[model samples]
Target: MSTDNTLPIEHLRWDAASARGPRELNADATAAVTDPGAGRWAFAVADGVGDNPAAAAAARTAADAAVGAATSDPRGAIMVAREALADAPDTGDCVLVVAVGGAGDRCEIAWVGDCRAYLWAEGTLRQVTEDHTLAAYFRARNLPVAPGMEHVVTTSVRTAAAELIGTADVPLPAGRLLLCSDGVHKTLPTARLRTILERAADPGGAVTDLVDTAHRLGGQDNATALVVDRTAEHTANSSAA
Candidate 1:
Protein backbone atom coordinates (compact mmCIF):
# COMPACT_ATOMS: atom_id res chain seq x y z
CA MET A 1 0.00 0.00 0.00
CA SER A 2 1.12 3.55 -0.66
CA THR A 3 0.21 7.04 0.66
CA ASP A 4 0.85 10.63 -0.41
CA ASN A 5 -2.47 12.41 -0.69
CA THR A 6 -1.37 14.75 2.10
CA LEU A 7 -4.68 14.88 3.92
CA PRO A 8 -4.60 16.90 7.12
CA ILE A 9 -5.00 15.25 10.54
CA GLU A 10 -4.44 16.87 13.89
CA HIS A 11 -4.05 16.08 17.59
CA LEU A 12 -3.13 12.43 17.11
CA ARG A 13 -0.29 10.33 18.54
CA TRP A 14 1.35 7.06 17.47
CA ASP A 15 4.29 4.70 18.18
CA ALA A 16 5.90 1.68 16.50
CA ALA A 17 8.07 -1.38 17.25
CA SER A 18 9.74 -4.08 15.11
CA ALA A 19 11.96 -7.12 15.66
CA ARG A 20 13.71 -9.69 13.51
CA GLY A 21 12.44 -13.19 13.94
CA PRO A 22 14.46 -16.46 13.75
CA ARG A 23 15.42 -15.69 10.16
CA GLU A 24 18.89 -14.58 9.19
CA LEU A 25 17.57 -11.32 7.78
CA ASN A 26 14.59 -9.32 8.99
CA ALA A 27 12.44 -8.71 5.91
CA ASP A 28 9.70 -6.69 7.54
CA ALA A 29 9.74 -2.88 7.34
CA THR A 30 7.55 -0.05 8.69
CA ALA A 31 7.07 3.69 8.15
CA ALA A 32 5.29 6.55 9.92
CA VAL A 33 5.59 9.92 8.18
CA THR A 34 3.95 12.97 9.69
CA ASP A 35 3.58 16.43 8.17
CA PRO A 36 2.87 18.63 11.13
CA GLY A 37 2.73 21.68 8.93
CA ALA A 38 -0.09 20.17 6.88
CA GLY A 39 -1.57 18.06 9.66
CA ARG A 40 -1.22 15.02 7.41
CA TRP A 41 0.16 11.61 8.39
CA ALA A 42 0.76 8.20 6.85
CA PHE A 43 1.57 4.80 8.38
CA ALA A 44 2.58 1.59 6.67
CA VAL A 45 4.08 -1.89 7.09
CA ALA A 46 5.56 -4.14 4.41
CA ASP A 47 6.60 -7.77 4.53
CA GLY A 48 9.02 -8.70 1.75
CA VAL A 49 8.22 -12.11 0.34
CA GLY A 50 10.91 -14.22 2.02
CA ASP A 51 11.32 -16.36 -1.04
CA ASN A 52 12.37 -13.33 -3.02
CA PRO A 53 15.97 -12.14 -2.88
CA ALA A 54 16.74 -8.82 -1.17
CA ALA A 55 13.47 -9.02 0.71
CA ALA A 56 14.55 -6.47 3.32
CA ALA A 57 15.36 -3.88 0.72
CA ALA A 58 12.07 -4.54 -0.99
CA ALA A 59 10.14 -4.01 2.22
CA ARG A 60 11.83 -0.71 3.03
CA THR A 61 11.60 0.60 -0.51
CA ALA A 62 7.92 -0.24 -0.75
CA ALA A 63 7.13 1.46 2.57
CA ASP A 64 9.05 4.69 1.89
CA ALA A 65 7.84 4.98 -1.67
CA ALA A 66 4.25 4.47 -0.64
CA VAL A 67 4.26 7.28 1.93
CA GLY A 68 6.06 9.71 -0.36
CA ALA A 69 3.46 9.61 -3.11
CA ALA A 70 -0.22 10.59 -3.67
CA THR A 71 -1.46 9.41 -0.28
CA SER A 72 -5.01 10.47 -1.07
CA ASP A 73 -4.87 7.86 -3.80
CA PRO A 74 -4.23 4.74 -1.78
CA ARG A 75 -4.35 2.39 -4.76
CA GLY A 76 -2.36 4.82 -6.84
CA ALA A 77 0.27 4.82 -4.14
CA ILE A 78 0.53 1.07 -4.50
CA MET A 79 1.23 1.51 -8.18
CA VAL A 80 3.75 4.21 -7.48
CA ALA A 81 5.51 1.98 -4.99
CA ARG A 82 5.47 -0.84 -7.49
CA GLU A 83 6.95 1.30 -10.21
CA ALA A 84 9.60 2.49 -7.80
CA LEU A 85 10.54 -1.12 -7.08
CA ALA A 86 10.89 -1.84 -10.77
CA ASP A 87 13.68 0.73 -10.96
CA ALA A 88 15.74 -1.37 -8.56
CA PRO A 89 16.10 -5.00 -9.57
CA ASP A 90 17.78 -5.82 -6.29
CA THR A 91 14.72 -4.84 -4.26
CA GLY A 92 12.50 -7.86 -5.14
CA ASP A 93 8.88 -7.53 -3.97
CA CYS A 94 6.72 -7.25 -0.85
CA VAL A 95 3.17 -7.31 0.47
CA LEU A 96 1.98 -4.15 2.17
CA VAL A 97 -0.85 -2.43 4.12
CA VAL A 98 -1.20 1.28 4.76
CA ALA A 99 -3.46 3.90 6.37
CA VAL A 100 -3.42 7.58 5.49
CA GLY A 101 -5.48 10.33 7.09
CA GLY A 102 -5.59 14.04 7.88
CA ALA A 103 -8.16 15.69 5.60
CA GLY A 104 -10.86 15.13 8.19
CA ASP A 105 -12.12 12.44 10.55
CA ARG A 106 -11.75 9.76 7.89
CA CYS A 107 -8.76 7.67 6.80
CA GLU A 108 -8.12 5.67 3.65
CA ILE A 109 -6.67 2.16 3.87
CA ALA A 110 -5.23 0.07 1.04
CA TRP A 111 -3.43 -3.24 1.03
CA VAL A 112 -1.90 -6.08 -0.95
CA GLY A 113 -1.01 -9.32 0.78
CA ASP A 114 -1.65 -9.96 4.48
CA CYS A 115 -0.30 -7.07 6.48
CA ARG A 116 -3.24 -5.83 8.56
CA ALA A 117 -4.87 -2.87 10.30
CA TYR A 118 -7.39 -2.85 13.15
CA LEU A 119 -9.60 -0.27 14.84
CA TRP A 120 -10.52 -0.27 18.52
CA ALA A 121 -13.53 1.79 19.37
CA GLU A 122 -16.64 1.92 21.56
CA GLY A 123 -15.31 -1.06 23.52
CA THR A 124 -14.98 -3.24 20.46
CA LEU A 125 -11.83 -4.33 18.57
CA ARG A 126 -12.45 -4.89 14.88
CA GLN A 127 -10.16 -5.89 12.04
CA VAL A 128 -10.34 -3.29 9.31
CA THR A 129 -8.53 -5.01 6.44
CA GLU A 130 -9.17 -8.53 5.27
CA ASP A 131 -6.21 -10.69 4.28
CA HIS A 132 -5.61 -11.05 0.52
CA THR A 133 -4.43 -14.63 0.64
CA LEU A 134 -6.05 -17.66 -0.95
CA ALA A 135 -6.98 -19.05 2.45
CA ALA A 136 -8.80 -15.86 3.28
CA TYR A 137 -10.60 -16.00 -0.06
CA PHE A 138 -11.77 -19.54 0.55
CA ARG A 139 -12.83 -18.78 4.07
CA ALA A 140 -14.74 -15.68 2.99
CA ARG A 141 -16.73 -17.74 0.55
CA ASN A 142 -17.33 -20.58 3.01
CA LEU A 143 -15.06 -22.87 1.06
CA PRO A 144 -12.58 -25.26 2.60
CA VAL A 145 -9.22 -23.77 3.49
CA ALA A 146 -6.53 -25.95 2.06
CA PRO A 147 -3.40 -26.41 4.13
CA GLY A 148 -0.92 -23.51 3.73
CA MET A 149 -3.35 -21.47 1.63
CA GLU A 150 -2.96 -18.68 4.13
CA HIS A 151 0.68 -18.28 3.08
CA VAL A 152 -0.17 -17.90 -0.61
CA VAL A 153 -0.89 -14.26 -1.21
CA THR A 154 -2.84 -13.47 -4.38
CA THR A 155 -1.17 -10.12 -5.11
CA SER A 156 1.71 -7.93 -4.02
CA VAL A 157 3.34 -4.56 -4.67
CA ARG A 158 5.39 -5.89 -7.57
CA THR A 159 2.59 -7.86 -9.22
CA ALA A 160 -0.51 -5.80 -8.51
CA ALA A 161 -3.12 -5.13 -11.22
CA ALA A 162 -6.52 -3.51 -11.43
CA GLU A 163 -8.86 -4.95 -8.78
CA LEU A 164 -5.95 -6.77 -7.16
CA ILE A 165 -5.73 -4.22 -4.38
CA GLY A 166 -8.00 -4.13 -1.33
CA THR A 167 -9.22 -0.84 0.05
CA ALA A 168 -11.50 0.80 2.63
CA ASP A 169 -12.30 4.28 3.81
CA VAL A 170 -13.33 4.57 7.45
CA PRO A 171 -14.07 7.22 10.01
CA LEU A 172 -10.82 7.39 11.91
CA PRO A 173 -12.15 6.30 15.28
CA ALA A 174 -11.42 8.36 18.37
CA GLY A 175 -10.28 5.46 20.48
CA ARG A 176 -7.30 3.40 19.20
CA LEU A 177 -5.75 2.25 15.90
CA LEU A 178 -3.26 -0.50 15.06
CA LEU A 179 -1.21 -1.43 11.99
CA CYS A 180 0.94 -4.57 12.15
CA SER A 181 2.80 -7.22 10.20
CA ASP A 182 1.64 -10.81 10.16
CA GLY A 183 4.33 -11.81 12.62
CA VAL A 184 2.55 -9.86 15.31
CA HIS A 185 -1.11 -10.65 14.55
CA LYS A 186 -0.58 -14.28 13.53
CA THR A 187 1.21 -14.77 16.84
CA LEU A 188 -0.98 -12.79 19.25
CA PRO A 189 -4.73 -13.33 19.47
CA THR A 190 -7.28 -10.48 19.21
CA ALA A 191 -8.23 -10.73 22.90
CA ARG A 192 -4.60 -10.42 23.94
CA LEU A 193 -4.06 -7.48 21.59
CA ARG A 194 -7.11 -5.76 23.05
CA THR A 195 -5.81 -6.22 26.58
CA ILE A 196 -2.45 -4.82 25.61
CA LEU A 197 -4.01 -1.77 23.98
CA GLU A 198 -6.49 -1.10 26.79
CA ARG A 199 -3.92 -1.53 29.58
CA ALA A 200 -1.03 0.16 27.84
CA ALA A 201 0.62 2.99 29.71
CA ASP A 202 1.04 4.74 26.37
CA PRO A 203 1.43 4.09 22.66
CA GLY A 204 5.10 3.24 22.95
CA GLY A 205 4.45 0.64 25.63
CA ALA A 206 1.63 -0.85 23.58
CA VAL A 207 3.90 -1.34 20.58
CA THR A 208 6.68 -2.71 22.76
CA ASP A 209 4.40 -5.16 24.52
CA LEU A 210 2.89 -6.29 21.23
CA VAL A 211 6.27 -7.15 19.73
CA ASP A 212 7.68 -8.60 22.95
CA THR A 213 4.61 -10.73 23.42
CA ALA A 214 4.93 -12.04 19.88
CA HIS A 215 8.42 -13.29 20.61
CA ARG A 216 7.49 -14.71 24.02
CA LEU A 217 4.63 -16.59 22.42
CA GLY A 218 7.05 -18.40 20.04
CA GLY A 219 6.38 -16.31 16.94
CA GLN A 220 8.87 -17.25 14.22
CA ASP A 221 8.29 -14.35 11.81
CA ASN A 222 9.64 -10.84 11.94
CA ALA A 223 7.35 -8.85 14.26
CA THR A 224 6.29 -5.24 13.63
CA ALA A 225 3.54 -3.10 15.16
CA LEU A 226 2.41 0.56 15.05
CA VAL A 227 -0.13 1.91 17.54
CA VAL A 228 -2.10 5.13 17.44
CA ASP A 229 -4.37 6.80 19.98
CA ARG A 230 -6.78 9.49 18.79
CA THR A 231 -8.54 10.34 22.06
CA ALA A 232 -7.52 13.80 23.21
CA GLU A 233 -6.50 12.54 26.66
CA HIS A 234 -4.48 9.58 25.37
CA THR A 235 -3.11 11.65 22.53
CA ALA A 236 -1.39 13.92 25.02
CA ASN A 237 0.35 10.94 26.55
CA SER A 238 1.24 9.04 23.35
CA SER A 239 3.00 11.68 21.29
CA ALA A 240 5.28 10.28 18.55
CA ALA A 241 8.04 12.47 19.91
Candidate 2:
Protein backbone atom coordinates (compact mmCIF):
# COMPACT_ATOMS: atom_id res chain seq x y z
CA MET A 1 0.00 0.00 0.00
CA SER A 2 1.02 3.63 -0.48
CA THR A 3 2.58 5.31 2.52
CA ASP A 4 3.27 8.95 3.22
CA ASN A 5 5.82 10.61 5.51
CA THR A 6 3.40 10.08 8.39
CA LEU A 7 3.81 6.30 8.35
CA PRO A 8 6.34 4.65 10.62
CA ILE A 9 8.97 2.51 8.94
CA GLU A 10 10.74 1.20 11.99
CA HIS A 11 9.69 -0.82 15.03
CA LEU A 12 7.41 -2.94 12.83
CA ARG A 13 7.90 -6.50 11.66
CA TRP A 14 5.54 -8.72 9.65
CA ASP A 15 5.27 -12.27 8.31
CA ALA A 16 2.71 -14.65 6.77
CA ALA A 17 1.91 -18.32 6.16
CA SER A 18 -0.87 -20.46 4.64
CA ALA A 19 -1.78 -24.13 4.49
CA ARG A 20 -4.48 -26.26 2.90
CA GLY A 21 -6.72 -27.79 5.55
CA PRO A 22 -7.85 -31.42 5.52
CA ARG A 23 -10.59 -31.02 2.89
CA GLU A 24 -8.97 -28.58 0.49
CA LEU A 25 -6.78 -29.78 -2.37
CA ASN A 26 -4.49 -26.76 -2.09
CA ALA A 27 -3.71 -23.87 0.17
CA ASP A 28 -5.62 -20.60 -0.13
CA ALA A 29 -3.38 -17.51 -0.32
CA THR A 30 -1.82 -14.75 1.82
CA ALA A 31 0.54 -11.78 1.48
CA ALA A 32 2.29 -9.33 3.82
CA VAL A 33 5.18 -6.90 3.43
CA THR A 34 6.45 -3.46 4.30
CA ASP A 35 7.29 -0.77 1.80
CA PRO A 36 10.78 0.38 2.66
CA GLY A 37 10.49 3.60 0.71
CA ALA A 38 7.03 4.75 1.80
CA GLY A 39 7.07 3.13 5.25
CA ARG A 40 3.82 1.15 4.88
CA TRP A 41 2.82 -2.46 5.00
CA ALA A 42 0.05 -4.19 3.03
CA PHE A 43 -1.54 -7.36 4.32
CA ALA A 44 -4.15 -9.67 2.81
CA VAL A 45 -5.69 -13.13 2.97
CA ALA A 46 -8.21 -14.86 0.67
CA ASP A 47 -10.11 -18.12 0.79
CA GLY A 48 -11.81 -19.71 -2.16
CA VAL A 49 -15.62 -19.74 -1.74
CA GLY A 50 -16.65 -23.31 -2.54
CA ASP A 51 -15.69 -26.59 -4.11
CA ASN A 52 -15.16 -25.09 -7.52
CA PRO A 53 -11.96 -26.31 -9.16
CA ALA A 54 -10.78 -22.74 -9.74
CA ALA A 55 -11.26 -21.67 -6.14
CA ALA A 56 -7.59 -21.83 -5.21
CA ALA A 57 -6.57 -19.79 -8.22
CA ALA A 58 -9.23 -17.22 -7.49
CA ALA A 59 -7.98 -16.80 -3.95
CA ARG A 60 -4.42 -16.25 -5.08
CA THR A 61 -5.34 -13.73 -7.76
CA ALA A 62 -7.69 -11.79 -5.52
CA ALA A 63 -5.12 -11.58 -2.72
CA ASP A 64 -2.38 -10.41 -5.07
CA ALA A 65 -4.63 -7.76 -6.53
CA ALA A 66 -5.81 -6.55 -3.16
CA VAL A 67 -2.31 -6.10 -1.71
CA GLY A 68 -1.04 -4.59 -4.94
CA ALA A 69 -3.73 -1.92 -4.87
CA ALA A 70 -3.53 -1.24 -1.13
CA THR A 71 -1.32 1.81 -1.63
CA SER A 72 -4.46 3.80 -2.44
CA ASP A 73 -7.86 3.59 -0.76
CA PRO A 74 -8.90 0.20 0.58
CA ARG A 75 -11.96 0.35 -1.69
CA GLY A 76 -9.75 0.85 -4.69
CA ALA A 77 -7.89 -2.32 -3.75
CA ILE A 78 -11.10 -4.36 -3.57
CA MET A 79 -12.32 -2.92 -6.84
CA VAL A 80 -9.08 -3.92 -8.48
CA ALA A 81 -9.72 -7.48 -7.38
CA ARG A 82 -13.23 -7.24 -8.79
CA GLU A 83 -11.88 -6.28 -12.17
CA ALA A 84 -9.33 -9.08 -12.04
CA LEU A 85 -12.07 -11.55 -11.15
CA ALA A 86 -14.24 -10.41 -14.06
CA ASP A 87 -11.37 -11.10 -16.43
CA ALA A 88 -11.08 -14.63 -15.08
CA PRO A 89 -14.64 -15.83 -15.39
CA ASP A 90 -13.91 -19.39 -14.32
CA THR A 91 -12.73 -18.43 -10.87
CA GLY A 92 -14.94 -19.34 -7.96
CA ASP A 93 -16.29 -16.98 -5.33
CA CYS A 94 -13.80 -16.09 -2.58
CA VAL A 95 -13.63 -14.16 0.66
CA LEU A 96 -11.05 -11.38 0.97
CA VAL A 97 -9.51 -9.19 3.70
CA VAL A 98 -7.00 -6.38 3.18
CA ALA A 99 -5.32 -4.05 5.66
CA VAL A 100 -3.03 -1.10 4.96
CA GLY A 101 -0.95 0.89 7.41
CA GLY A 102 1.65 3.62 7.27
CA ALA A 103 3.46 5.94 9.72
CA GLY A 104 0.35 7.68 11.03
CA ASP A 105 -0.41 5.32 13.92
CA ARG A 106 -3.52 4.15 12.08
CA CYS A 107 -4.65 1.25 9.93
CA GLU A 108 -7.51 0.74 7.49
CA ILE A 109 -9.23 -2.43 6.36
CA ALA A 110 -11.43 -3.48 3.44
CA TRP A 111 -13.12 -6.80 3.37
CA VAL A 112 -15.67 -9.07 1.69
CA GLY A 113 -16.98 -12.40 2.95
CA ASP A 114 -15.56 -13.92 6.16
CA CYS A 115 -11.79 -13.56 6.19
CA ARG A 116 -10.89 -11.43 9.23
CA ALA A 117 -8.42 -9.01 10.81
CA TYR A 118 -7.77 -8.43 14.50
CA LEU A 119 -5.74 -6.20 16.79
CA TRP A 120 -4.06 -7.74 19.81
CA ALA A 121 -3.01 -5.08 22.30
CA GLU A 122 -2.16 -5.12 25.99
CA GLY A 123 -3.06 -8.82 26.28
CA THR A 124 -6.50 -8.35 24.72
CA LEU A 125 -7.34 -9.44 21.19
CA ARG A 126 -10.27 -7.82 19.44
CA GLN A 127 -11.70 -8.35 15.97
CA VAL A 128 -11.22 -5.31 13.76
CA THR A 129 -13.12 -6.42 10.66
CA GLU A 130 -16.71 -7.63 10.57
CA ASP A 131 -17.70 -10.83 8.83
CA HIS A 132 -20.07 -10.44 5.88
CA THR A 133 -21.68 -13.86 6.21
CA LEU A 134 -25.39 -14.37 6.70
CA ALA A 135 -24.75 -15.73 10.18
CA ALA A 136 -22.96 -12.59 11.29
CA TYR A 137 -25.68 -10.39 9.85
CA PHE A 138 -28.33 -12.28 11.76
CA ARG A 139 -26.29 -12.16 14.95
CA ALA A 140 -25.82 -8.41 14.60
CA ARG A 141 -29.58 -8.01 14.19
CA ASN A 142 -30.31 -10.32 17.13
CA LEU A 143 -32.27 -12.68 14.92
CA PRO A 144 -32.02 -16.39 14.35
CA VAL A 145 -30.03 -17.52 11.36
CA ALA A 146 -31.78 -19.19 8.48
CA PRO A 147 -31.18 -22.92 8.23
CA GLY A 148 -28.20 -23.99 6.12
CA MET A 149 -27.27 -20.40 5.31
CA GLU A 150 -24.88 -19.72 8.17
CA HIS A 151 -21.90 -20.08 5.88
CA VAL A 152 -23.38 -18.09 3.05
CA VAL A 153 -21.44 -14.86 2.50
CA THR A 154 -23.53 -11.73 1.91
CA THR A 155 -20.93 -10.23 -0.42
CA SER A 156 -17.62 -10.95 -2.14
CA VAL A 157 -15.09 -8.97 -4.12
CA ARG A 158 -16.08 -10.61 -7.37
CA THR A 159 -19.73 -10.27 -6.46
CA ALA A 160 -20.09 -6.76 -5.03
CA ALA A 161 -19.24 -3.19 -5.95
CA ALA A 162 -16.86 -1.06 -3.88
CA GLU A 163 -19.72 0.80 -2.19
CA LEU A 164 -21.26 -2.48 -1.08
CA ILE A 165 -18.07 -3.71 0.62
CA GLY A 166 -17.08 -3.26 4.27
CA THR A 167 -14.41 -0.91 5.64
CA ALA A 168 -12.88 -0.04 9.02
CA ASP A 169 -10.22 2.30 10.40
CA VAL A 170 -8.62 1.89 13.79
CA PRO A 171 -5.68 3.41 15.59
CA LEU A 172 -2.59 1.24 15.61
CA PRO A 173 -2.28 -0.49 18.92
CA ALA A 174 0.64 -1.37 21.21
CA GLY A 175 0.68 -5.10 20.37
CA ARG A 176 0.31 -7.42 17.41
CA LEU A 177 -2.12 -7.22 14.46
CA LEU A 178 -3.40 -10.45 12.94
CA LEU A 179 -5.10 -11.32 9.68
CA CYS A 180 -6.44 -14.83 9.29
CA SER A 181 -8.76 -17.06 7.29
CA ASP A 182 -11.83 -18.86 8.67
CA GLY A 183 -9.94 -22.09 8.98
CA VAL A 184 -7.70 -20.68 11.67
CA HIS A 185 -10.19 -18.60 13.62
CA LYS A 186 -12.97 -21.18 13.35
CA THR A 187 -10.86 -23.97 14.76
CA LEU A 188 -9.10 -22.12 17.57
CA PRO A 189 -10.56 -20.06 20.39
CA THR A 190 -9.47 -16.45 20.68
CA ALA A 191 -8.17 -17.03 24.19
CA ARG A 192 -5.85 -19.75 22.98
CA LEU A 193 -4.77 -17.66 20.01
CA ARG A 194 -3.90 -14.79 22.31
CA THR A 195 -1.63 -17.04 24.27
CA ILE A 196 0.16 -18.13 21.14
CA LEU A 197 0.55 -14.62 19.78
CA GLU A 198 1.79 -13.24 23.06
CA ARG A 199 4.48 -15.89 23.22
CA ALA A 200 5.72 -15.53 19.67
CA ALA A 201 9.00 -13.65 19.32
CA ASP A 202 8.74 -12.92 15.62
CA PRO A 203 6.15 -12.76 12.84
CA GLY A 204 7.47 -15.89 11.10
CA GLY A 205 7.18 -17.96 14.24
CA ALA A 206 3.80 -16.52 15.15
CA VAL A 207 2.21 -17.27 11.79
CA THR A 208 3.78 -20.70 11.52
CA ASP A 209 2.62 -21.61 14.98
CA LEU A 210 -0.89 -20.37 14.18
CA VAL A 211 -1.17 -22.49 11.03
CA ASP A 212 0.04 -25.51 12.91
CA THR A 213 -2.37 -24.87 15.73
CA ALA A 214 -5.28 -24.75 13.29
CA HIS A 215 -4.17 -28.00 11.70
CA ARG A 216 -3.84 -29.64 15.10
CA LEU A 217 -7.37 -28.49 15.85
CA GLY A 218 -8.61 -30.10 12.61
CA GLY A 219 -9.07 -27.29 10.19
CA GLN A 220 -11.73 -28.11 7.61
CA ASP A 221 -10.72 -25.38 5.17
CA ASN A 222 -7.51 -23.67 4.15
CA ALA A 223 -5.85 -21.73 6.98
CA THR A 224 -3.70 -18.63 6.81
CA ALA A 225 -2.20 -16.10 9.22
CA LEU A 226 -0.35 -12.79 8.98
CA VAL A 227 1.14 -10.93 11.93
CA VAL A 228 2.29 -7.33 12.17
CA ASP A 229 4.15 -6.16 15.21
CA ARG A 230 4.44 -2.50 16.16
CA THR A 231 5.99 -2.96 19.56
CA ALA A 232 9.11 -0.93 20.24
CA GLU A 233 11.11 -3.88 21.49
CA HIS A 234 11.32 -5.23 17.95
CA THR A 235 11.81 -3.98 14.39
CA ALA A 236 10.59 -5.43 11.08
CA ASN A 237 14.01 -5.74 9.48
CA SER A 238 15.84 -7.29 12.39
CA SER A 239 16.12 -10.54 10.49
CA ALA A 240 17.95 -8.72 7.74
CA ALA A 241 20.04 -6.75 10.21
Which candidate leads in TM-score?
1
The global Cα lDDT (0 to 1) of model 1 is 0.83
- RMSD values for the candidates in order, in angstroms, are 4.7, 4.6
For each candidate, give its TM-score against the true structure.
Answer: 0.89, 0.88
Clashing pairs in 2: 1-71, 2-71, 6-103, 7-102, 7-103, 8-103, 13-236
Best by lDDT: 1
Residues 141-235, candidate 1, lDDT per residue (tens digit)?
A: 99999879988998899999948899998876577789999899999999999899888877789999999999999998899998877765434
Candidate 2 lDDT tens digits, 164-192: 78899987755788999888888889887
- Model 2 lowest lDDT segment of ten: 1-10
Model 2 regions lying over 4 Å from their true place = 1-8, 233-241
